[model samples]
Target: MAPSIQSLSMIHDSQECIKPIPAFSCCYLLRSCVRHASLYIGSTPDPARRLAQHNGDRYGAAKRTLRENLRPWEMVAIVSGFTSRVAALQFEWAWQNTKVSRHADLDGNATQELGVRICPRTAKEVKRVAKPRTSLTNILANLHLLLRSPYFSKWPIEVRFFSADVHRVWQVWLQRVDGLLNDGIRVVTDFAPDGISEVEGKELLAGAGRVGTLDVGYNSIKEYVEKSQFLLEDGERINCGVCKQRLILQHDIIAVCSHSSCHCAAHLSCLSSHFLKDKDSDSELVPREGTCPTCYSKLEWLTMMKEISLRLRGQAEVNRLFGRRQRAGTPKGQGLKSVRGRGHSEDENESDALQVSTGLDTVNLPPCSDGPWTIDCAIGVLGGIAHRPGGVSSGNDSDATVTPEIETHPQRCRRNQNTRTQRLGLQKSAMINLSDWYDAEVIE
Candidate 1:
């Protein structure tokens, strides 16, 4: 039987339930900001005591906005299975400070991290704060890391992924996942292989907290290629600097080189130059067992120069491939032809020749009307102002300045430029969300 809220005071008298908490241990707390509807993440050694303090409104801290909102069930525990308490604490702190929670959806759409399994508490019970055991700590650590990601920023309230096996769901969900991204919804969760990394997870989480719009999702270079207009010829080709082979540009083999320096084809023979150069005076080039010469930086100066040329050529090819896609009518995924099937080679020439409408075809602009504040009126006013003489408008021009000597301030101009650059930076980042492209219709 579950304990009732009324029994909390009596339960404190009992000694069997509570245990001593370890010092400097790690655990996390996520409080919902009532007014702003945003989430504030935190962590500490004693979750039970810390939560009781918040609910009791002990010090009345401003950041603790959920004092009155804590229900009996909201005092749930987050369990992690770390090998040590220190590791748990480190994971918790890193999670709160960075992309772990924010990018949860992209990390894998794990919703459990944001979970609040509230339980009744009493002041007496709170005095002895209970620390989670190892199993619980590890679980919590996983949850925290998974939740902090760009994709999971907009996670629906109260959802989390809990098992490693859940990752298989993604393989089956590929189509649905792509649709979500195309519709401007990015989901992140820690169960994802990439999302588990401490470095990437924290980076994404910090990004999401700063901007509510950052959505986390599983992303890869393959996704980029498939979604863009870069073409591949053969799937087997490798993109190593020395390889000069024709390849079907599939997701795995898109890096094969068409450059001049290390123009080896993608095959066992492609790595010969690298091996032959690196071999000792007595060593000969052995088939199927050679490392790269240029990239390894192990060969002679002349060979390095040759490798450098190959690298440059590789970069140029990459630029050209992407450039061609831009000129083509298709956006990202619609431009590239993965297999040789329809029409021509589906190269840039084909893409350029075709006409395509961008996704913003449905934007509705209000019609022009007979209003004093019309855009035309504004343009006409600007023209008249520019037509005025340098000193001041001669004869009763109400808009004319009295002083022609009021020169533009260089400092002010510089400040304005800086402001513009910052705004531009923000706008560019916002565009990555792709929110503007998505449209939902009213069923009614």
Candidate 2:
């Protein structure tokens, strides 16, 4: 029987409700080709589509970029690695209003001076301070300052420059900047081929041609999630590698070792705390990298987080991983709805909902003990220093095996009060707005 129009609408709504949200957000820089001085800064989950919207090829473009005079726009660069869309938006707002933002002062005066005293300013005095002009120089300077700010310094952020001219300016500014960017933050240059004309660049930016090549440093979420699926399927009780406590699949957020041979598993909080111990700063909620407890392999915290994101929110991937096929006659929306309603779920649908409802599930795991192997020790072993009963020895008996020195320098840590709480908050907020980026159909 043919379904009614009302029935079709209901099914569509149901499908939209269950759509999986991607955990990605980035702040982008756009310049008006017509007027080189005119620039715009915005944030979005998808940069390519956002660029198209600004060029009048799609809907939902900001009023500022809609004028015929500024008909075409070019993306200069993008800053990614924000923990959430909210984080990216906060950054966007700060970048747009740098002069008044509390982050403007480099001396820590603004943050510390707040609530100490409020000297009233006259209308004339207020009017005397001109608004900071938005130029390429000022924009890059503010970006440098914001990245160094204590609030954002610890984040594993990466800056990618798509324009060769802009990248040269950035390089010059970095030398002039007072302080250096955090070691964890990466600066990438993905400029188009030399001798490419302005029109060619525009075509690339408009999605008609490939722009610059992106050098992805870590494993993608799909590959990471698929490889780690055995942890859920093995049926053996999994325990936290740090705390040595059994991991409850439905209750605790889990992180697995990225190394293919290693099967280390732990509560997200437990792993985070374990990684933070190596640094001088304990106030941080995220660690850039740490040695695995089981295999002693170095693991990137950002990579693990990406895998966790897929496990938590990627419904289609999860279904495929578990071999959960829909019944032949069932509607797609109905099939997804049924998959979500099962209790003690294999798909983690219930747990994801619970995490959304509550801020985050706090797991009270015991403090991590010192690991038997350190990263230095692992390096030494890989360098042909074999471990004997007492200590490590070199390849030759006559040669002395110098002990590998552990890193003592205090590395900066990414600070946030709560780990899981903020992560879950990101997931919840991102899921709600997933449709905004995904549902739109680009004209080109």
Q: For candidate 2, lDDT tens digit of each residue in 1-444?
A: 122457545644565344333356789888787775678999987777787788887898998999988768888889988876788999999888776788767464232222121112211112232224545666777888888888888888899888766777677666555578889889997766778897787666545233223322222555567777877668789888998988766556678999987888987778887788866576776789998988988998877876775566655656664555553432233223212211322342332321111011111112223212221111121122222232333333322222212222112112332444433333343312221122211111
Task: State TM-scores per candidate.
Answer: 0.20, 0.60
Q: What is the clash count for each candidate, in the order shown?
A: 78, 0
Q: Candidate 2 at residue 341, lDDT? A: 18
Off by over 4 Å in 1: 1-29, 32-68, 71-208, 211-245, 249-252, 256-444
RMSD of each: 26.2, 28.4
Where in model 2 is the C-alpha error above 4 Å? 1-22, 106-132, 206-219, 313-444
Q: What's model 1's overall lDDT?
A: 0.32
Location of the lowest summed lDDT over 10 successive residues in candidate 2: 354-363
Best candidate per lDDT, number? 2
lDDT of each: 0.32, 0.60
